[model samples]
Target: MKFLIVFVALFALALAAPSDKDTVIVEQNSEVLPDGYTANLKLSDGTDIESSGKLEKAGTDEEALEVQGKYTYADPEGKVHTINYRAGVDGFQPQGEDIPVAPVA
Candidate 1:
């Protein structure tokens, strides 16, 4: 009888534990320009430019970006470009709406 009681208690505890597989994480990145803000500019032919930002989130797959910064991009040829961007919670929903919860036999 004691053994049976212990087994049931352990089973209940296991069920109460949170499942890591059900959790999700999200990340984002952005960049800012030195100037106040700039508009679109044409880049010189055969020139390439790149910029980067950072983001970090946990607890849910959804990411909510309350604000975003402005950034500028300039090509090697000295062509200038500017852009303003913002982000928010996006692409966050359960893969399946009707996941079955099976009873522990």
Candidate 2:
């Protein structure tokens, strides 16, 4: 009976463990661009969100850059919405404006 209880407890513990495939890891790195160059973030779902302005150094620091971009995503009803983000020395802050999405050609 003790052996059966131990096996059942181990089975329950194994069931409660998190699988590696269910985790997502994000790595932050700086992307360099030429002058007047703009970057676009293309999502895996075919959403092409463009940057509003060029990225520049937030200050004299070499660690981070200021990113000004808009992110667009589609809802279950097929309605697209845009959320603008700005990254500075204080970190990323999302703007409240939601722009309508344009159809991707």
Candidate 3:
């Protein structure tokens, strides 16, 4: 009877244990552009949901490459947004309306 009770408790614990599982799928691709290279990535949530981005660059200045690219994706609310940018010795600059003008030094 004691062995039966212990076996029942173990079985109950095993049934209550959570299963470790991940169901996200990711796919990626890349290619050489005329002036630079571009890469793409995709992630799927199994419910027709996904996100992606890309990066590319070209031209060199003082051992630095002028990097520029844009990425767009839809949010959970179905609103689409994009980010265009450039980066180099001057640092990362985003394309937007509110340009930060340097105050007269």
What is the C-alpha lDDT profile of model 3 across 11-78, one tens digit per residue?
A: 33342233343324365555544444444444342222111222223233344444555444444565
lDDT of each candidate versus the true structure: 0.31, 0.46, 0.42
Residue 22 of model 1: what lDDT?
39
Ranking by TM-score: 2, 3, 1
* Cα lDDT over the full model 1: 0.31
**Residue range with the least summed lDDT across 10 consecutive positions in model 1:** 35-44
TM-score of 1: 0.25
lDDT of 1 by residue, 1-105 (tens): 223224333532342233423322122222233321212211223112222222335234642222333334333455654444343344212222233446799
Ranking by lDDT: 2, 3, 1
Q: How many angstroms is residue 91 displaced in model 3 relative to the true structure, after the best TM-score fit?
A: 1.1
Tell me the TM-score of each prediction against the true structure. 0.25, 0.42, 0.41
The TM-score that candidate 3 achieves is 0.41
Query: Global lDDT for candidate 2?
Result: 0.46
Best by lDDT: 2
TM-score winner: 2
Candidate 2 at residue 8, lDDT?
30
